[model samples]
Target: MSATAAISVRGLEKSYKGSRQARSPVLKGVDFEVARGSIFALLGSNGAGKTTAVRILSTLLKPDAGTALVEGASVVEEAQRVREAISLTGQFAAVDEILTGRENLVLVAKLRHLPSPGDIADGLLERFDLVEAGGRKVATYSGGMRRRLDIAMSLIGSPSVIFLDEPTTGLDPEARLEVWKVVKELTEQGTTVLLTTQYLEEAEQLADRIAILHGGTIIANGTLAELKALLPPAKVEYVEKQPSLEEIFLSLTGSTKQGDHS
Candidate 1:
């Protein structure tokens, strides 16, 4: 493991027991490293073990094989230390609809046994741009707002690393962009992030480096330019760029990111 790497994985493997006696393999000797304060994307389709890798690294699930280190602590051997150094925000928004946004943030801070939970909640609410909505029930938040609050909640303990599993899934283009901006801001604050997504544009727009998981192993790993270099350079050709359907729709309907736009 590199000294500057916030996460390091080598020869990772995992499998699950299926019906009767059959075993289904997911990860097969996977390996990668994420530098501290950088965004590393894990790209793969459904059932490609992207989430499985995150689960193991976050110490939510034990790996069947291989070594995973989070902030220099072994995930399996020093699970508690790993947990203390990391936070996870899964695909779905795990907010309590029954509580207001402020209440939700305070809840997580308290759960982490942090000092001045109320102050912590206030800071996060302001940081996430949820000040006005902070007093409102989470049930009323838009997909973007809910997702933002979920991420803010994850920062309650000030974890050094954050695992965002398919963070922008199911969001509208505008909402997705909103989350993208937030992700960019996270890295700017020196937080290491491991993002998993099936969205190609998401990875292209955010990751400092990308690794593609296919058939239970890493098939590609490199920067955007490096990965693009793998393919033959395009022959020179001139073509006019046209606005995409998303641009046209957003231009025509002028749908706001608030309310039911999600």
Candidate 2:
């Protein structure tokens, strides 16, 4: 593991066992390194093994082979240590439904055994713009509000690394931007983040570097410009109109949308 690498994985492999002719791999000889205090994005389609890799790094699941190091500590040998140093926010909001926004934050703080749970909760609430909704039950909050609270709870422990698994999946355009702003704040504060998203725009907007997984392996890995350079420059079509085609289609067909507009 490099001294500056927050995470280092070499020859990582995982497989599920079932009846007959087993040894089907989810990750095949995976190798990568994430620099300290950087935002790294992992991109892949569904069942591409991105989530499995995150689970291993977060110490929720163990790899069948190879080694993983988080902050230079062996993930397999020091699984507990890795868990202590990292936090994960998955596809859905992880906030407690019954608890108020403030209570949820405080609960996480207490779980992490922070020195000052109340202060941490208050600070996070204010930082995330949840103070106005602090007293409201999470179940009653808007989608965006609940998502904000979930992210706020994730930060209460002050873990050096965070894994966000499609944090903006169900958010509206404005809500997605709000989540992006929070992610930017985390990086600015020198926190290392590993984010997994299927959204290409999200990776382009936020990742310092990106790794694209296809068929359970890293098919491509580099910065946004570098990745784009690998492919022909796209020809963007710009149209000036009061209402866009997508908007018209959605209005006409009533299709739901995801992600930011700009």
Candidate 3:
């Protein structure tokens, strides 16, 4: 692990077993570093080992080959300490369906040994705008609401590093934007966040640096600007000599997407 990085991986590898057949390797000697307090996006197609990498970093799974470190602690040798520094929200919201929103938050806070579970639970509920529905069971919550609660629960211990694996997967456009705002706020507060997503736009919206993974390896890793520079600067064409469809799209969408060619 580098002194400056919040999370680091070097030659990491993971494989799954199946009978006596050769184990299928998911991550093949991957290497990357997430700078402290930055949103680093891990972009990949489905089954490209994005979740596997996240699992290793979050200490939910160990790498079969090489090393992974979180906040300068070895994930294999110092897993407990590494786990102390990180929180993870996986593909599914981990909230209990039987528990009310407030109950779920309080449960997590209590599990974290927070001194004031009530205060912490209330604070997160309000911050996530779940105050009105706080008393409702998670089963009654919408997908977006459940996702918010899941993320809110992860913050109970205020872990310095957060690993989000496709955090906004099932969210609608508006809900996705709301989640993006929350992720941005996390980075602004000096929380290091490593996000894994298949959506290029999501990475462009939240990531300070993007790593594009393919076939179990990172094919490209750089800032949006740096990666954009590697390609030809775009040219525009208007329909009525006024503005083209791309122009209208750009006007509404913003220049960020042009750089999101990941």
Tens digit of per-residue lDDT, candidate 2, span 78-136: 98898889889998998788989888888878877778888998898899998888988
User: Candidate 1: lDDT over CA atoms?
Assistant: 0.87
Which scores higher on lDDT, 1 or 3?
1
Please report how far candidate 3 places residue 161 from its true position, in Å. 0.5
Say which candidate scores most in TM-score.
Answer: 1
- Which residue pairs show collisions in model 2? none
Of 1 and 2, the candidate ranking higher by lDDT: 1
Cand. 3 Cα-lDDT: 0.84
Report lDDT (Cα) of residue 143, candidate 1. 95
lDDT of 3 by residue, 1-262 (tens): 6799998889999999868887988889999999999999988767778989988887888789999889889998999999899899988899899989999999988887879999999999999999999999899988888888898999888899999999988788987887898899888989999999878688877889988776788767888776665554565555323332223223333343433321
Q: Which ten residues in a row have the lowest lDDT in candidate 3?
A: 240-249
Higher-TM-score candidate of 1 and 3: 1
RMSD of each: 7.3, 6.6, 5.8
TM-scores of the candidates are 0.90, 0.86, 0.87
Ranking by TM-score: 1, 3, 2
Weakest 10 consecutive residues of candidate 1 by summed lDDT: 253-262
What's the count of clashing pairs in each model shown? 0, 0, 1
